[model samples]
Target: MTQADDLADEERRLRQLRLVVDITAQILAEDRHLTLCEALRLIEAARTTAGRLFPGRQDTFDLVVRPRLERIVLERFGIVSTAPVN
Candidate 1:
């Protein structure tokens, strides 16, 4: 592929990654009570797409997706404290 084509592909992948992250954040913010299955499904989809778009870069998927999902799950289940102070 030409340089321009490669740049376009990269840009598109970046956009997709952003979308996935945003959606995951939205889901977590809207309903912290997401079930395990629901979280897995979302994570799996993001992982698959990320892996395909950026092969050999598992850290991108792990870093961008897994941490957020884990954080949300932990916060939702009270594994991590988010207590409010008055």
Candidate 2:
């Protein structure tokens, strides 16, 4: 659309990104004993909240945060998924 509209959208997306990062950091800090299932649930809740708060911001959060978080989870817990080790 117009330049002003584009700028507003960018600003809104940035604000949502910051919120998501802050929430994730808090969750990661507080939930040291989380199981894999619990970690997945936390990620899902973060995604849901991001979508509900910003509607079309899911893509932004997913693109920016999901991969990094996945890496952190894997590294922190030494998680390695293999196919039955057969």
Candidate 3:
């Protein structure tokens, strides 16, 4: 991919992460804490395209949504990126 393509891809990833941050924040706003089951439930409740197809499968939640939510939570609390710099 060209430099522009890379930049665009990064931008898209950041946007998606931001959306995850926002939605996860809203869903977890009530107690500011959640049990593992609670977190899974929240992800299952999402109305995204994948959610509609896959429903509440724990495997889907773990493989996809959970990591994004974890990253956003970490990012919000001033933990520097664990992702290695390119």
Which predicted model would earn the best lDDT?
1
Q: lDDT tens string, model 3, 1-86?
A: 99999888768755665576467656654445566567556555553534434355556656766666656545444457767755
Q: What is the C-alpha lDDT of each candidate?
A: 0.76, 0.73, 0.58
Candidate 2 achieves a global lDDT of 0.73
lDDT of 1 by residue, 1-86 (tens): 99999999999998987887788767865675777678767777777777888898878778667877767766665575465633
Q: Sorted by TM-score, highest first, which candidate order results?
A: 1, 2, 3
Instruction: Give the runs in model 3 whose Cα sits over 4 Å from its true position.
Output: 31-36, 40-86
What would you estimate as the lDDT of candidate 1? Answer: 0.76
Segments in model 2 whose C-alpha atoms lie over 4 Å from true places: 1-17, 81-86
Counting clashing residue pairs in each candidate, in order, gives 0, 0, 0
Candidate with the larger lDDT of 1 and 3 = 1
For model 3 the TM-score comes to 0.40
Location of the lowest summed lDDT over 10 successive residues in candidate 1: 77-86
